[model samples]
Target: MKTSTPVGTQADQLQVTEDGKPLDAVRGTRAGDLDLRRTVLWWKGFEEQVVSRQQELHGIGEDVVLAAQAADTALQESPPRLAGEVFSAVAEGFSTVPGEVPRLLVPWFAELARSIGREVSTRSLADAAGAGVTAVQRAGAPPAGTPSLLDALVPAAEALVGAEAAGVPAVAALHAAYRAAADGTRRTVEDGTVDPGALLVAWFFERGTVV
Candidate 1:
């Protein structure tokens, strides 16, 4: 029997490409040099454009920082089974008894569906939410013929509903929804469909009016 190459080693030797061109060819530079330059530039841009701006906007207040830290810690400590139960309840509720959705949330859901290349409507959203709930309750993979984007939308819907159930403040619930949508965008990108940046921007534009 032949032995297989280690996954990590194979990944390390894999050549990543953009538009079918190797990074070096695309950049017209040595790959290693380009990689280092890109890494440094990304870090600098993140610090200056994200961290600095956030600090300025939030004033680096201890209360805000502590609250954020606490949330992160709680999320990290949550057991997967418990989290799944919470997500399942939210999904089920949306599918069965999503009461009088605020008018604002509909547009956000429509935009999110459109961003993921799906037609949007109350019925379709309810169906997707129902499918998600069924999948969770069965403790198995999603049913055959399930749309791929459900992998993202289910969690995004769960986050929104869960926030509401927890009685999170309105502003915080909106933020949670946006964050969940961002996470969903990331998942689609990893699935090799949807432009991450474009989807993220779509979510951001809808964020203000959601919840």
Candidate 2:
């Protein structure tokens, strides 16, 4: 249940990178580049509010519902048995996804909603990063959710660093990147867009893979 060292603890590095190279959190597949230091800080500051924060993603919150509904509809469209498995996974809090992968559920579902031709709402974009930042940070360490979360986070934080380097305020870059990754308003990672669901399965959840 212990969490790994947050990303920012390195000595005087301007940005965090993978294999000594910069990567994008929203887009990068190999490494998570989101600033772990900020993520940890944000999580600690908001833990009291988000750890117990429970709202049906997109089901009960603002326009996020449209995104949530789209993901649900997409799941329903899958083969009945596979759909059932996905639903079961959801019910089990993404137990099979490994690490702090579950913390990304809200964002992943929101992004999945976007992938299925639904529009990612502004509310969903903001809420996902806001609440999700705290949620991921609150998870446990390696073999639990923390390591995975931290791994996933590397790219996300790196993306924000890029945003800031481009003159975006440090305070606003995270939300902006999260929104861009979700809505396709802009590219946060190198590949073009972010797919939280696929990322979970292909990168985080699946074993012997990128992680």
Candidate 3:
């Protein structure tokens, strides 16, 4: 629960390749590239919002749903089921973004959410991310019913948020990478021609959308 947590992936099976790098929240990801690119400034934007603020991720508004109530028309991040709270909470507060979020959600991310087959108009942010993630695996198909996306990353987000809330700089840096991967995936899918399912892992790598 403290900031001493080592960075890892949402899925227990997947691992982050930190290489032999120093985890510095103040400096941002040890990423060698992407810092020089112009079209994409999110690397730094995310760093400022999330990574640099890692010690505060826990304070990221646990009321993810309560805070998003007015913005979220459907889902609520209530007890026993706050797993997918990101979707609803984000929907409720996304319009006032940056300041509103513990970490920044992807900007103009709705279209990509829809691309991932999520019902953007209805689901919460956690749910939408879930849908986006699921869409890629089903070959661009939407989930049949209640299968949630937040369900996949919830624990990781929570764990990372704990570090942020605790004020751990290094942990925050890892969270920034996660945001970059999330947003970058959305940017790439905007092309309207990429296959959602095919680019699952690419989203985490900041390749934009996919091949």
Candidate 3: where is the Cα deviation over 4 Å? 1-146, 170-211
The root-mean-square deviation over C-alpha atoms between each candidate and the true structure, in angstroms, is 20.3, 16.4, 17.4
Model 2 whole-model lDDT (C-alpha atoms):
0.31
In model 2, where do residues sit more than 4 Å from their true spots? 1-74, 77-118, 121-123, 141-147, 154-211
RMSD of 2: 16.4
lDDT for each candidate structure: 0.32, 0.31, 0.29
Instruction: Locate the minimum summed-lDDT window of 10 residues in model 3.
Output: 202-211
- lDDT by residue for model 3 over 55-157, one digit each (tens)? 3223343323232333333333331132223233333344444432312232213323333231111122233344444433343222322222232233323
Judge candidate 1 at residue 147 and give its lDDT. Answer: 22
State residue 56's C-alpha deviation in candidate 1, in Å.
29
Alpha-carbon TM-score of each model against the true structure: 0.28, 0.27, 0.23
How far does residue 65 in candidate 1 sit from its true spot (Å)?
Answer: 38
What value does the lDDT take at residue 91 in candidate 3? Answer: 34
Model with the higher TM-score, candidate 1 or 3: 1
**How much is 100 displaced in model 1, in angstroms?**
26
What lDDT score goes with residue 186 in model 2? 14
Better of 2 and 3 by lDDT: 2
Error at 92, model 3, angstroms: 20
